[model samples]
Target chain A: MQIETGELINITDKGNNLFHLIIKADKIADKALPGQFIQVYCSEGESYDPLLPRPFSLFRIEKEKGCLELVFRVVGRGTSWLSKRHTGSSLKLLGPLGRGFTDPREFSRVLIFAGGIGMPPLFSVAEVSKEVDFTLFYGARSQGELIFLERWQQMTDQIFLATDDGSAGQQGNIVELASSLLDSGSADFYYACGPRPMLKAVKRLMAKLKIPGELSLEERMACGVGACLGCVCRTTSGYARVCTEGPVFAAEEVVFNE
Target chain B: MNDPRLIVKVGQFSLKNPVLTASGTFGFAREYNRLFPVSALGGIAAKGLTVQPRAGNPPPRLVETPSGLINAIGLQNPGLTAFLQQELPFLRELGTAVIVNIAGFTIDEFAHLASVLDGETGITALEVNISCPNVKKGGMAFGIHPEAAARVTRTVREATSLPVWVKLSPNVTAITEIAQAVEEAGADAITLINTLPGMAIDIKNRRPVLGNISGGLSGPAVKPVALHHLWQVYKAVKIPIVGMGGISTPEDALEFIMAGATAVAVGTAMFHDPYTPLKIINGLSGYLDVEQVGRVEDLIGIAHKKDGLD
Candidate 1:
């Protein structure tokens, strides 16, 4: 993990308040991996209004061009400030921090679940392990929120989608869709990233099916490194820092709070 | 001339500079060492240690407020035995002064911690943390009251031969009363102020944001409160003061020194920028050169002095 100033090379409006940012940061891109994240300083120099840096998963790592991609939505002040930045500006990033997902190539059959902004890290997993067979179950609020659909379709034919309003593939939720599909199908391993409810439901499904998997977690972080112990998630062992021990953990190891 | 001297003395020991990373913020100096050489700083107070391992509070441990962060880490540490066996050796070799911050449930626990660390090499001093606001039993429970605060300070003072710096809490009625009480009890220096008790609510959930319900507030938000308390305590106590709370930049550190602090500690700002302490050290050097000051020691409590204005 190093602090690198990455120049904003490009910005794409993925629509529905979601943005795709590409930064030219050689060192950070060189070190980044799937499921790892970078802490972006929202404000310009010497400003502490939004005092803490916001953590973002490495949506895409283009090492050859020394570029890193971030996918974020304008949810609050920090992301709002991030959205207003123009191309050619610079962002201070501290990354590629935290333990990432298990190498996708290690598993013969892989299942991926992504919800809303949670798609980035899992998308990274699919991008890195192209040779591995993957079944993606993606859910969003509606059709507009289902970002990068063409990209996922290009990657695999086994893509399944769900939207809350039934404006997309399946109605209700992605967890139920994935659960029903898995009744006749089997995967060696699974990976999930999304809202806590989705993750919890996936965890339950994985437990019921007796399939081992990993879940990427999120929390409000202070020190992106483990120094502060601010972003910890309860685990079977005890509390583990999401900044270090995870942003990803074995599904079974996590004890989700009710 | 050569670079302006950044060195300053706190109690009996001399620090290489007037900048120290606040306890709980810097960890054991191991984490920040990955970003920069921690030895460049004046000193480091390791995270608060207890007699036994603490799991701390549950998740949602932190919440970002306006220009501040509220955290209820609850002093989760690797316990005393692990510190001696695993952490201290690494700290001893950091080539910087290591001030171990200890928290305890009772006065005896405080004494026990001090006694165990008494002859430990490479430790510059013992920062008795009676100011932590997260824990239910010992932390600020002893800190809010003068007699209790003085009792903890006196017990630790007797247990160890090292310099004792009592870290004070801002969530008190009269901070000076506790400061003076600790001074009278044999505290060599005072570290004020710990995070001010504060909370945030999740409006959607209609619940408190932090898992601990309420946590101590730190960062730029508490700067004024910390400075006010430090200014008051500086007048009440003769011992040196290690001023902290929302200290991030060289200007902030200079403000603390001018307000009567011998040294200043960078706390919540380190979360925003890990290189903050190093930046402050260089900034201090640059400030001294620009002002034509000889040493950082020359500026201590300068604001409190009655000059031509008086």
Candidate 2:
């Protein structure tokens, strides 16, 4: 995938303290795959204060509009600036980077798992594919953090929600929910993207059930390409770059530390 | 007319230009494809590879200082084998000379790395990193001492016929001695300076900003130091020098050339502007033509004294 510099055209607060930034970059949209991301340069406040741009998975690409979308939560100065930008704000970007999910060949059933911000990238994967026997397992801290549920639910064949507080769907983690489904012989291959712990949990469950899967690891990156040697993951073979070799790696190949 | 023919030979490799991306900054040169074609630049120095694969240190691995950045990535790499199998194919297809930068924990590790890379003909050059302070032991990064530096360079030089460039650390008191040592040991050229080791305190958190307490400081903060090192070593060694550290602008690239660098590698500048190398290359080409410069090599070491008056 090609890495391009993007200009922030408009930043819309998607309310609930979330933001939907419309960044205009044709190169990003043209080259971006499902799970690939863009490192947004929003550290404009202090010169060299926030050293690097924050990495965000691509949400959707609007080619005709000449813009790409990033759904981000304001957790720091970088996202805060991204959330407040007006139209015609130019933001530098390096992206369409990291290996995305490998497109499955004709499988009977596909299982999709996402927790928190992880849902955004999976949304694209689901959007690109056809009407297959697919089930999406989504988990969050509470009902409010179950982001992009309405639209994603409408897109997929089946939707299962699990929140930590039990304030939403099943009162359990997504891994437990997935284990039951796989036990019922409803899943063929699993695809997951989320925080490290959640991914680790799901990977363990997959291994226990002898189910095959692909995982998208979220690592803090420097170059967002293979150059920085900053975002690296240990695998059965050796070290793999999260930016180039993957953000998505086969479950069997990885050796999760924690 | 712009001289698109700024190609020059550095060591045995013939580069399209004298501008190359510094290791740990340019990311295999693919990151810039969205903005410009990477082939437009002279070359790409792959991120530091290691003997065994490294997961690197935990983030926040990077922190921005005044005009520089401190990164303690800990030489995270997927080892040489995986890189060759997975990433090297794509890198070779980019049609630019790929300089593989390898780090070792021991003398044998460096030799093993070179031996493993010997059969990989797609690689244009091998850059030996002996300057990373973030790793444990043999990250002996070769530049710390003249003896250690020469030993590592000589080992790699014996292992492969590929042109070897030893990337030097800037934290040392004297850099020329090490440069001379590597040159005498048969290094094709030298890349200087690696990031200087430094620390930053998070006033609010009242602790260090980097996960690794100390990180390498790069960017504009280290440009003057880079110039000094380049100036000192350029006179001490007859081999070519690729100057880096905190270069961000065309003027900065010119300054390195004036200080006797045959080429300039843009580092922390990549963090700020991903298209910096292209900009520097284009800017240099423009500056050279306008100044009636006949060749890029003429710019190297032009900052000489008037008949030893200085």
Candidate 3:
């Protein structure tokens, strides 16, 4: 991993409080993978009020243009400060950190599940693997919360969306939609990134169907490296750091906490 | 025309500089080495080690307060045997001082660890962690009491020939009393101000944020407390002090040095920016040049000089 200062090239309001930021970081963009993330130093300069760097997964890696894109929502102080940054401002970034997803080309048919903000990394998977046949199950709280709808529709061979309010595709959650649509041998491999409840439900369903898959996990992090042991999740082996051991892990390896 | 002298002598051992990475914050020095050269710093203290591999506390182990972070990592480490076989060889090649911080649940555990690590080639000193607030037993328990603190120090001192620096807790009523007791009990030097005990509640969840319920507080919020304690300890003992807590910038490190610390460790601030120690090293050289000071050691305890504003 490398620390590089990247200029903010573009910032787009994806609507409903979501934003897409593209940074010009040649080294990070060149090294970053589908599910890997970058730690964004949010403090303006020497200020230590917001004391830790915030982690954001790679939404799109524009290597040819020497740029990296991140999709984030304004949740707390760090992201709030990040959202207000101007395009010309420099952003200090540490990345291409963490283990990312496996190569999608390894499987003939892939199934993807994305929940709200979790869509960024999975969206990257769909964007890069054009040769693989992908079926996507994307969900959000409502039609307004859904982002990159057009891009996702264009990228995947088949797209399924679920909204809690029934204002979009399916009326229920994404896991319910996936369960109703998929059966044994529906796909060779599956991938998911979402809220814990959804991931837990998906893990159970995938086990019942006996399909191998990977899950992207999230935790509050410091150091954004393996050192601190701050961001860890319970796995079959033990508590593994989410920053280094993964933001991605085998579906069966993860043991969700109650 | 020559570079200002950055070398600092702590007891019999001399460090290349005054900036050392704090234990628990810097895990084995492998992570930050990927970003910058680790050999430039004065010293590195590996994570606190125990007799057995600990899984540590449960998740949600960290919470960020105003300008501080509360963490109950519960001294998670690879245990003593793993360190010798796995981490020590890598540390030896770093071309810097390696100070091992040992945490024990009992006095024998502390002595055993020191004895085993005594003749190790790369290790410069043994830092007895009597001040860790996260663990359930034998950490701050031995630290808060002067007699108990001295007993731990005495045992480690008797077990090893290496210079023993006892790290003291800031949570005590009389930090100087504990400092004096350890010094009298044969401590070669002192490392002051392990994190103060703190807790954060998740208001919506109506529960404690950390899995251990309470954790140790570190970062900028504890700077004043750490410096005050360091100043008091400096006056009470002749042993050199390694002052640390909320030290992020060069200015902060200078404050600790002026307050009579031969060295300072950067802890929580490293989590904010891994380059913090390197930045402070450069900043110190710049400060010395501008101030016309010939040596950093000359400035140690200058704030305590009776001629200054007293």
Candidate 4:
């Protein structure tokens, strides 16, 4: 199961600042769960300005190809370097880290609230929830920011779209749309991911509406695994790592910044 | 048939290989266990641990820009005592060398931490991080100033019998001076190039992206800068160097070694690829075999510096 660093390969550059990077790492992939993430070294031959690797969520994986796919935003120097990379580039990856989302087997009607870059994790959850009746309430700052909508639309039976600028579907925060849908008494269980402010507002709305939900939190992380404890969040139990204990947490268990 | 393996001696302990995971990148050797064996690595340099546990900075501690990332993680850790009780036991069992990295707010805190961990059986060494930018006052990082770096190194050296590796920050004007100071103050080795200082803006919000205005930048963007520092400092000091900065592949790791780094460390790459360290190791081995090179150490400082080119 051990692979030499040279064996890690980049299979595809799925454009739009996203990459379908393959590491030739099977053991790590086999053990990887839905909500967990991986740390990838994008630039092989060049050492740019920042000397550290960036952590990303495992977007999709092809076990047959022995490759792992990462859906990442080219936010900074790390990703910008990654975005420029072409095929046949080699990468250094450490992964399948952080505690993933809880399984959706228990819930009947699942609602996934995703925003912008947060859609990656929610996408994974949606893929796993194929057999279940789930409604993905997706939102973005503008219509152009809405990614993976068509592919998700094809997979799930119901998809709701919202944007802050109303360049697309129902305009407003995703929480507003989600709350209205919740009022209709259709959603049984909900999972959400998005900006911190959005997630905070969601947590508050969930409390007001008394909805049972699980939130996948995203905090700035050093080591996507639990090493640095850089991505700690205050929860009802105690301080827990977003990378280790969860990017996913029960709405009731976490204590957001009020 | 020379061994591609490397065994480096730092203080009283001997590391199987000079290679190690940089602090803040690899968790406590346990997080990667499910994917790769912790024992596979030469050692695990844990995240920066302070005297007391810290909550770290506010939200938006990290922002990705260009070929790098800016972070002000603020040294969020479980504190040394908690790490010793909760995480150390598992790390010790992984059969990998454990290097504890310390960041202190004051001279006494650093001294006290070293004293507390002195003669610890599980830990192989201590890496003093004098370069975190998030903290205020004494913690703008001891790595920024030569005297400050030396003082922290000397204080920690006097407190513990373990090998001390002083991790240098790249934000300084003269890296060589700081490197020399750490060496003269009894540091066993040096970890070059922490994240560089940076900032980002969210156009929609028309304000700073991160809650903290400035953050430390890491990833491929800093590799060239890191390599330059390593090369320059290598010529300035006799102590072994651990070079890291945007090292995302085996070739990158090799570049560091050839630039006079005794070993290389993996950092921001872990964010993009979690198995980066193992991949780099595998790559190095394959590369050595393909090149028909006997020992990996022979590649150290092999970069031919053309005189007039500089």
Indicate which candidate wins on DockQ: 1
- Range of the 10 consecutive residues with the lowest summed lDDT in candidate 3 chain B: B1-10
lDDT for residue B253 in candidate 2, whole number 0-100: 89
- TM-score per candidate, chains pooled: 0.98, 0.78, 0.98, 0.75
For each prediction in turn, the share of the native Cα contacts (below 8 Å between chains A and B) that it retains comes to 0.79, 0.45, 0.75, 0.48
Off by over 4 Å in 1: A183-185, B1-4, B308-310
**lDDT tens readout by residue for model 3, A1-258:** 989999999998878778899999999999989999999998977799799999999889999999999999898899989988888999999998999999999999889999989989998887777999999999999998888888887886499999999999899899999999899789988889999999999999988988899999999899998888989889999899999999999999999877
Query: What is candidate 1's DockQ?
Result: 0.86
**Residue pairs whose backbone atoms clash in candidate 2:** A3-B34, A227-B27, A239-B78, B130-B141, B130-B142, B219-B246
DockQ comparisons of all candidates to the true complex:
0.86, 0.28, 0.83, 0.31
Docking class of 3: high
> How many clashing residue pairs appear in each of the predictions shown?
0, 6, 0, 61
How far residue A21's Cα lies from its native spot in candidate 2, in Å, is 2.1
TM-score, cand. 3? 0.98
lDDT of 4: 0.76
DockQ of 4: 0.31
lDDT for each residue of candidate 3 in B60-164, tens digit (9 for 90 to 100): 899998899999888889898899999999999998899999999999999899999997889999899999898888899999999999999999999999999
> Relative to the unseen true structure, what is the C-alpha lDDT of residue B269 in candidate 3, on a scale of 0 to 100?
93
